[model samples]
Target: MDKTPLTDPALAQLFTQARTYNSWSDRPVDDATVRQLYALVSAGPTTANSHPGRFVFIRSAAARARLRPHLSAGNVEKTMAAPCCVIVAYDTRFHEFMPQLFPSRDFSATFAGKDAVIADTAMRSSTLAGAYLILAARALGLDAGPMSGFDKDTLEAEFFPDGRWKANFLCNIGYGTDDQLFPRNPRLAFEQACLDL
Candidate 1:
């Protein structure tokens, strides 16, 4: 496959210029946009195409109310104010769809009986998918605030009482406001953070 580099503006939208918004505008996110965001996220690669990520978009007042108590004190106001809060979760039984996802052959048996591998792969793939969700939303002209400041155990119990899915992280998405933005933080240089073997 031949591909050209994306335009500078596109790159900026997806990375450098994109901010983690802590405040959102009053603009509402419609269901169609949410669905489109997931369509893009689902196309991202995952381990053996396990594709474990499951998303729950909390947009309605009732849903937000249900989510409130699970948030950390610092995350509550921002999350509640955002137009949508997504629960990025992983399906524990994702391997069962290996025949469909991988297609060439069934890889279900490789993970089904292995608890550790299942948990590790599910978490890894779901985290990757969650990252895709962020980038996808940005590409679609939306802002995202990825967060981890929530009570995982209780949140999972509240959202996934069936035990089939487990929460990995949370992300609030919508039209963002600069109302709560702080200065951009610095990142480690390659020499400081990576090894060139």
Candidate 2:
């Protein structure tokens, strides 16, 4: 841990005070802000810095309309109403960058031929990168609502026509409305969720 931890107010803003919002205010999130958010997120650690995560920021009405048909009934209205929804995805060919990003060992060729390893690495690293984006958003004074309640195949077909990128999840971004938040749910106790082996 750092000699001095983050201030309590900052901690609360990013963690305790944060809620997975189902309603958004009319305030818009600009392209610059989202770009800054990505820069922050990309700096987080990843396996071999594979940096597989990719994002599609759905801002236009047409894009949102296209996404709606893929979302579950419970997610459509809220997702569509948000200012933007980020499609967090992974590139199947992420290993192609290993030579550039991890030149010390330069294992790109080895990774390129291993389909199972590629799939596992892409899924795990991309999911972690998505989580980083959520934290980065809160750190930048924006709220995030991450969801996995969409038809992945439909989203990929509609958005990633080349078939190289695949959707991992979706996260809506914007200012939030308090009335839409449900009562807080309790989290597991430390002993129940952690093991100190």
Considering every candidate listed, which one attains the maximal TM-score? 1
lDDT of 1 by residue, 67-93 (tens): 999999999999999999999999999
Query: 52 in model 2: Cα distance from truth in Å?
Result: 0.4
lDDT of 1 at 81: 96
Model 1, position 109, has a per-residue lDDT of 71
Candidate 1: stretches off by over 4 Å: none
Among the numbered candidates, top lDDT falls to: 1
Poorest lDDT segment (10 consecutive residues) of candidate 2: 103-112
**Whole-model lDDT, candidate 1?**
0.95
RMSD, one per candidate, in order: 1.0, 1.5
Looking at model 2, residue 85 earns an lDDT score of 97
What would the C-alpha RMSD of candidate 2 be, to one decimal place? 1.5
Cα lDDT tens digits for candidate 2, 1-197: 55888999999989988889999998999989989999998999998888999999999999998999999999988998899999999999999888788888968667868999999999999999999989999999999999999999988999999999999999999988986899889999999999999
